[model samples]
Target: MDHNINTKTEEETITSTSIHQESKLLGSNKSSYKQILAIGGGKGGVGKTLVTANFAITLARAGAKVTLVDLDLGGANLHTCLGVEMSSRTLSDVFSSDIENIEDLCAPTIVPNLQLISGAHDSLNAANLPHAQKQKLIQRLQQLKSDYVILDLGAGTSFNTLDFFIAADVGILVVLPEPTSIENAYRFIKSAFYRKLKNIEHQLDARELVDKIVEKKEELGIKTPADLLSAIENESSDLGGKVRLAMNEMNLKLVVNQTRTGTDAEIGFGVKNVCKKYFGINVDYLGNLEYDSAVWQSVRRRKPLAVEFPTNPLVATMQKMVGHIVAEQAEKIKNEKSYE
Candidate 1:
């Protein structure tokens, strides 16, 4: 994909920020200070792990400490992607008495400021991780000392995946330019949005209301989250307002990978628009990764694209996306402080 494309330039507004201040604020001892970025997709082989590994490298190279967590569960290979030997101290160790802290599993990588917590030692049923264990893992991840934590999530909309995706400060969904991929991407978003709503339905005292609305959404003419909120408002405006706030608070992003053409690169914007219209969610299109044979060559060499092919055009695109993410995150922090 040509980054020089006029359309690409018009679509992306890359922002700049001070990495020193970002590191100072985000790398604090407080777990809440850490920034969590979860990369997931509905279908497999959409380059989720590739994005996670490269993005972590980009951040680390930018002077921020980064950790890559292989939450892909039963099928973990992030270690292989980064050319790191699989460590004995994997996430599976956490389930046993031998390991008490998640940080104890951190393994160094070729990159200076990047660490990894591999999931390679997990059991076949690791994908079906117990809820309590998953929650504990998420908390520990937040408590990690790294300035940035990138989760390489498993494909599908399993409850575990949805919960982890929702737990992150930023949720990014990877998609390909095809019908099947697009459909699954939509399914993943819908599942995640409802999962979030379900978690807070009890708090809003609208469990039955939400269930009824979703069940009869077709009959009730509710097509989007906004439509459902309008229906709830008819019954109780206060509950509707709270639910609306929850919806607005969702931070999600879009990235189209393996783009072979300009139309493929444009898929991100199309997905973003569909999401806004169908789910009433604002998904930031974080640019695209053009299809490159070098990606596969790097994989065969067991190295991250950024490290193996430093001059690759795809690396430049990845850098642009990371810049936008950092700038937006910094702005978010500034806005929150003003409110405080």
Candidate 2:
């Protein structure tokens, strides 16, 4: 944590136009795409990176080409989670001009069709990456050659993390059954929703209105996405339509991890219902990873649960979730084709 790393570079003006147009990158333009799944949570120790590593390994084991990009700039240990030591080349190398293209930084792993771009343990400033660098990374990531590119993001509501999550093909928020995890998950959702709203359109008028809604603080203030939508409608029906459409397109998903029991398993449904009620967005609960003492054994062995304990219940759950994701992507392709 050096002072230079935090404020070394002057903060540049980053407009939201690029992110606002990211969702339009459907297979309509390209026949196929390397699906980018960004995993994040508002708080640490909720198993976000572990989930990213195992899920990426699960996809690779299923024969899908996968590139796991460890974007946890603060604490980069995803390589260790996969039992792979830190690569000689990492994000720092790319920043230092040692590597020209990030695609070249891929370090081969034991699993077939799987590669990893390790985060730099030495680049403390990388956590506060400049806006230009952030955009560059996001664009280069889209060009990666793989069926799935999983971005293992750091835990927090920082705009850097949210921008990565928001610009991805799919954003998965990992939550534990614990109360603190649930609260952080909700905060993450709200922060992400507002970040997206700020870029719903380039028009100063619409952004100004969104700013007003976000700035409200009262007993019945704009406390939810639905509330913001109502305010937009009061201002102008046309803008409200645009805002609602933007909110719907987010399609934020949830994954309940480390559920300890049957009762804990029921938390996903409750969280989904509450999100829909307050956020005015339907949150799809992708699946959950049951609390397994053996998960630590797998970790101690320095291997992913999906790799070391393929038959574990959590691995089975990962398999089911992977199938669902694959099917959903296929359907999106099919529907895009029909329109064409």
Candidate 3:
């Protein structure tokens, strides 16, 4: 099972073949290589689902085909946020053989060019999916034929959550301005970085070194991934170079939600700078989402923020964030093509 995009050589080939077969099923003649985006958090109630739902709507309204997946498993509620009724065949059905492919489980959303894959109506232990099952689902997600496939992940640094976050081409970590939220976000990112390194430990030939640094981080003066990398370089510069290259390739976007004051809004920048200094990771602050009564109102009304309160100021900020994300993705694709 490939845990992260950086080490998906085998999974990539399998995904490509699966995607080609799925393209014919979906009647998509253009292409089936959809960009995977995962919205995650360190804790629940950070508005991760809210941001994901609205982001999907904004992208679809902009004429991009979008699929919003509720991967929260047993705690799924993304459908409620999007005002979409759960399909009879949820993601759980895919595992049970009731639904052969995930694409067949897609249910139409109110927003045109948008589809919903609800995670509701699952078994008791849906969240604790087996390793093989999780890998299969990830591969099927890659086979989705759309411009973007957005996953609303469950909270915490659980292996399931971290794996899905790492699998995505783009990961957006949502956090509140509160101290607890910020701390949880840091833990989430740190755990993810460690998990990514562990995934490629064999190639780096530093499994023992990484394990030692993590297990006795304080004793070894390894406070962060950057510290661990420096220690590794001290041991073997060649191995350290490889680790540095991998860490540099990791890209994440941050969003501070429910900000009420100017100070709250600045939290995103602080977190971004801290990540670079401590973890040696590039975190793009995609701006903050202010506190708005309309958010809860929309929830009460069982509709998306854009639909329930189109004139809300928060909606405008979300639109700008979505625009920026789309522009960045376009630039990245262009650069990759140029290099090719």
Candidate RMSDs in Å, in order, are 4.8, 10.5, 8.8
Residue runs of model 2 more than 4 Å from their true location after superposition: 1-32, 203-205, 211-221, 234-238
Using TM-score as the yardstick, the better of models 2 and 3 is 3
Instruction: Return whichever of 1 and 3 wins on lDDT.
Output: 1
Model 3, 135: alpha-carbon shift in Å? 0.4
Q: In candidate 3, what are the lDDT values of residues 33-84, reduced to their tens digit? A: 5678899988999999889998887666665678988988778998886767
- The prediction achieving the highest lDDT against the true structure is 1
Summing lDDT over every window of 10 consecutive residues in candidate 1, give the lowest-scoring window: 2-11
Question: Which 10 consecutive positions of candidate 3 have the poorest summed lDDT?
Answer: 1-10
**TM-score of candidate 2 on Cα atoms, chains taken together:** 0.85
Deviating ranges (above 4 Å) for candidate 3? 1-30, 203-220, 236-238
In candidate 2, how many Å is residue 171 off?
0.9
Which candidate ranks first by TM-score, i.e. highest?
Answer: 1
- Give the alpha carbon lDDT tens digit for every residue of 5-107 in model 1: 2322211234223456554554553345878999998999999988999888877777678999998888899999777799987887776556666788999
- Residue 113 in model 3: lDDT: 75
